[model samples]
Target: MNTTTLLFEAPGPRGRRRCRLFEIISWAVLAGIAYLVIQTLDKRGAFDAAAWQPLGQLGVWRQLGVGLLNNVRAAVVGMLLSMFFGCFLGWGLLSGHKIVRYPCRAFTDLFNGIPVLLLLFFTSLALPAWGLPLTDFWFLVIALSLYSTAVIADLVRAGVQALPRGESEAAAALGFSGLQSMWLILLPQALRMMSPALVSQMVIVFKGTTLAFVLGGYFDLLRAATVLGAYYSRSLLQAQGIAAVAFMLINIALSQTAAAIDRRERRRYGVPPIGTGSRSPGMPE
Candidate 1:
């Protein structure tokens, strides 16, 4: 209650009544939407037993598992590369040298404005035309990595900026160089504070693998679902439903794992789980 009141005063009786009315209206609206959707799906025979039966087959799951593996493989590799380049570019964006900062700034502005779909298309077509024999997997990974690299670079910059200015003063008093203070002190706290946002980006990375369907010959989950639908004849919806569920489950697992690591790191390093201007892990307070 105290924390809630910090943002604004606690709701009075009339305000609480109004909130209750709003909740009731919102639920009623959602219920109406659910009923309409169910009716539409029923009219389309989406609930037919045959349409959903392939979901129970072992072979169907095996195929999905294979495609899901490709999605995970690309997403995992893309995220790693994004983080590496994101950090490097992020650091470069803050560099004292115009040579480094200007190029990094230009890179971020240029790539960040372009859509990921365009990047994927460009990579798929341009690389092969340029006589690079890279596989479609590399094409997809590279595209996703390029866009996320800019986003994460921005996150890094914002994270550091959100830190209190006094941290820099303290680092200076301890005779640390600007680079030393940033790399050792500011970046760590900034990353900790940005952990939740990073996890969200990881989710985006995984979902972006669906764009691989456009590249053809890729075994991402969407393609695998298409193959399954062809095999099962009338079960495309079922296969797609399973794929959606799989994506959701994996995303949930990723978020939870990230949260666990953030918690463990904070506890191990004797820092607040989240807050402002804290020292890096293992640094003397």
Candidate 2:
């Protein structure tokens, strides 16, 4: 009997060629679609100087700033409030007492199940009858916070669940109280794991500020664009262009902020560098 050893090889030149070909085809299709869109817009005069004049006007920028300021204020307030509520609710849910956990779970589920627009409408309209003294902006902020909090609560709960049981057992072995174990040992690690989800929720809350239009205020980017379009004789394209630019700017800002926070978390926790086998910079040995 003769024994022969066969060396296994990773995907080679042929595999690489197929991947390159696939990428080229994907890019070609994308470029073709973009060209077709441009041609269609050009035929419709969408790229004309007159068509884009509204965007060039200085008043448009001022209007955009005012609208953006209001929305930013609302988003910031809502995000802060939502984070507070979420942390509390999450803590309650993981308190190890059914009475505390069940109610929190119920509330989170109830709020998450509701449509954001309906929640804003009810807050702005129904709450006023009960003498809530809530303005449209405030009402919208409250609604957004409540909705976003529910989502954040779930993120917190998942983070807590992902924590190792040994940590809690060790804390118990050390005679640490339950609250102490939670506050010092569990929550910090959980918060680090939860940061990405919180940032995503923040982006959603920021975008959700656009629903303020339903509350009868011209305080959001969408309403501002609509007003500008009305002034320009109902040019839907102009309105859409304004809104697109505004939302793009907002999303870019949020993405940058999230990236910064993620970097900070990695540095703080000394987590291993992504895709590297080495231990992260701040992690314990």
Best by lDDT: 1
lDDT of each: 0.86, 0.80
lDDT per residue for candidate 2 within 59-93, as digits (tens), equals 88898788888888999999999988887898888
| Clashes per candidate, residues 3 or more apart or on different chains | 0, 5
Kindly list the per-residue Cα lDDT of model 1 for residues 141-215, writing each as its tens digit: 999999999988988888787678999899999999988998899998888777767887898999999999998
Candidate 2 error regions (>4 Å): 1-36, 164-177, 180-185, 234-236, 267-285
Residue 204 of model 2, lDDT score: 88
Model 1 CA RMSD to the hidden true structure, in angstroms: 5.0
When summed lDDT is taken over every stretch of 10 residues in candidate 1, the lowest stretch is 1-10
Model 2, CA-based lDDT? 0.80
* Decoy 2 TM-score against native: 0.76
Find the candidate with the highest TM-score and give its number: 1
